[model samples]
Target: MQVYCTKQHANNGSNRFCTQCGEPLPLAVGQVIDNRYQIIRQLGQGGFGRTYLAEDKNQFHQTCVLKEFAPQVKEPQDLQKAKELFEREANVLKKLQHPQIPRFHTSLQVKLGNKDFFLLVQDYVDGDDYSQLLEQRQSHGKTFSEEEVTTLLRQILPVLSYIHSLDVVHRDISPDNLILRSSDHLPMLIDFGGVKQLPASQGFWFTKLAGNHTLLGKKGYAPEEQLRQGKVYLNSDLYSLAVTILVLLTGKEPQKLYDSYQGLWYWGKEINVSPQLEAVLKKMLAYKPSDRYQTAEQILKNLPLLTATKPPTTHLTKLKTMIVAPGRQRANALVSKFHNKTQAVAKSIPLPVWIRPFAVSLGGTALVVLTGAGTWAVVNAVIRSVTSITIPSISLPEIPQLPNPLGQPVSDKGTKDNTQIISRRQQLEIPEVFFIKMVDELFYTSKPELKGRSLTSKAEDTALRNEWYDVASNFLDKLEQANLSTATRQKLGNYRSQDYEIWRRQARAGQLGNYTISQLNKDTNEKFDRLFPGQQRGKLNQQTFGQIWYAIAADQVSKLKSSN
Candidate 1:
């Protein structure tokens, strides 16, 4: 096992000192910590401790990131206090659940040689951070476009909104902490080591925790209040995010863009953007916390052309807390809430078999109609578990008679002619909400425990494959029947095909199941939250589950572009 010393000299695992420099090595490759994670190499170091890339041997040897907590405190009591505070903060960090944020697994306390080390384990995100991406662009004599930065802000602000609503401040939102995930080409927020939680009800706990005076956050990116007083507000992250955008836009470091003597930002001279975006960025970079946009949602609302981008499904609000139960009770609760909410607009709409999970299932038949324009509709059928528990055998339901929204006669194939459908659709001016729901519901389904269980027989596998094919066919048939505009039809059809192909591929690999609708939105968003929270200026607004559909589709498009 190779280990590097402070002077960058390599040494053997058993060697205490480097053969050339005689510097001590804290850890070595192949060293297992806490009998689970095996260190691969050192990633980096900061004021607190170093980061290491490791693999969890117990979990199929999955790669993960390990952050060590080695604070510089002389007194033993101070070190103990710091460790206690770190553990408490880790507990809070564990609650963060978002696709863009790395999942915090657990914390550990272990001894290496004579020192006690605390470590936090998290899922390893494979991607280059924005800082690194900027350097790559600089090598090509280019910088991030205003459109790219605008897209970045629009995507990441919702993440900030999610965490900030839970009363947790990232405290660090620089380009270095924002990674562009390779899997989806979406900007992922990483490195929560500097997160600060300021729960209003736990004032005393916060006071004691804040007494550490660790001075978190980067020097140039952090706002004045955070750097000087060690105080963090939700908007503190916004201030740092704006700085990052300027850095990416100008291809200049933060210090170069700012005039320290005059206490002003002169990044505008380096690059130009739209007046609306410039105004939003300027407001976000305000020196004083109160003078800036208060929350991430504020910045999202004021962002130029955000409303024109897509459906009104922005998830910038606080989610209502929900309880997750098992069996029919859980299924009923989810379907009941969605049924009542969408009843007004969704009149006895015969939902296709594939999207039945997004509507209310009456015995064997599923019927649904959505109410609010942006409301996410959920429908779950109570499929009794198979007694053998080997492979689920869900019998496909027949397609019901179609209800012509145009009140036109349907042909034998269960669809009006394209001319009639388009003419009537134009007269009514109906948006593609149904199409959006169809694509988005694919991801909202729950995952059944199929781990370590293979199909009992090849016949069962073939049966499941046929079921998936039938579902895809039904989806295409539904799209054809809708006769949407060519652009909408192709976009939604591609999404459905993308998802269907993935499931089919998983089946070929012996990893497919008849999963039901997930009660927790698969933990994407909080359940039972009001679909709409009004259009107040500064308040948070909830995003419908349907929004995830487009977000995924957009991500797929981005990845395709990157690959090209």
Candidate 2:
């Protein structure tokens, strides 16, 4: 049998004191704390207290981390303050709810011999920390690539964003604090001991045993501002993360990667990475907090997509080559030359100008061939090509069966009828020009109220737009609640769904860009003008637009049902 002494050094069960430190050992192996958690082994020890790997007897012997808050303070006031800080950490952990963060179990006081000890329990993350992983890689003469680093950033930045949302700054963020989970290989942020809420005025408390307000982070990893003045911002974590990545990439300490005299990092030439990522890291590691990215979201938005080693040769390029030759004769000659060489090129010719407009309106759901002439074969081929082309930032909703306006019919077997109705009303062959006009009228309208009534301020305009968008969403929700055919429901579901919801929320929060808003306005105005013309346009707000579109859609659905 073995018992861990106060210094966490393993000693024989018969030893009364630590083998190395000579500190008196109290807790023994397999001893239960508070009749709930059974001590298994000591994981680590720090200036404040020790951390243990324990099993919760109450939770089917589940493994958990038990953090002891035994600050080495002699003064009664300092001890009380330490206890307060410990409790505050507990409270902060309780409020944090993120998949990448360790879950806080509970906090309790346990009597070990004559002393009462404070302990906090948290979920035990099962995996190696980045530091250990780096060491392992170093041992094998390997290091993390830029792609792996980017993946790590993507996994952990969201966790930082979540904590920052609650106005909490993780004072300590380094490779040691990030544990890669065995289940998903995603990094899990651990050790909330250095978490401090911003606006410093809101209850200033921390584990400052020396009473000097010294910085609370590992040396060589913490930024200058944090090390010197104990000052930290939301981006301080970003700086630490940059240092950590640099260390991982080079397999060297941060100090080795940086030149203290020049106050600049010398890691660019050391590793081969994309210029875009290099620029992002440089910005993140900026000395001034204001110079760094203001938020995690900003970093995410600016982070470049990983460039592939081999350049992608798209089919569109081949099609363009065949179509855009010197002259019509030359173009036809080039098409002939490649017609047999590349069957794909022959099949992917662009759709006729008239049919192209419909494709845009349907958001690439399905292409309907209205004309049954020689163009039918061309249209089918073009449809296949269009479907193959991946459109960025456009996700088509799943097409659902049209609902029966009448109540569902039950069969003799006491089961609801499973008959599926496909919506053909959408295929009602309106001219390409008429389709565009209808879309314009449905999305926007020129109203007398909006004619000269400009917003007083940007804030006011943003708020008003967000309010109107919500009204529009609510209107759609109401329509969805009504008894409509599955086809009608599916059609309605396609519009004002995910995209509108995201845009509205971002606009309300003032996170959306002016360019996006302008594009939306232009597209919507054209659609609304086509749907409701002149005096029938009514108010230009989202609510009125929503009502108008819904009315027109319901009328169309009614016509289809009556015709059937």
Best by TM-score: 1
Give the Cα lDDT of each candidate: 0.51, 0.51
Give the per-residue lDDT of model 1 (tens digit) for 61-171: 777889876543446776676677888778777888876689999999876755566788998765557776676566446677665677677668878888877787878
Candidate 2 per-residue C-alpha lDDT over 279-370 given as tens digits, one digit per residue, 9 for 90 to 100: 98999999898999988877776765533432211111111101110000000000111212111111122333333433211455542221
The clash numbers for all candidates, in the given order, read: 6, 21
Clashes of 2: 21
lDDT of 2 at 154: 58
Tell me how many residue pairs clash in candidate 1. Answer: 6
Worst lDDT run of 10 residues, candidate 2, spans 325-334
Say what the RMSD of model 1 is.
Answer: 20.3
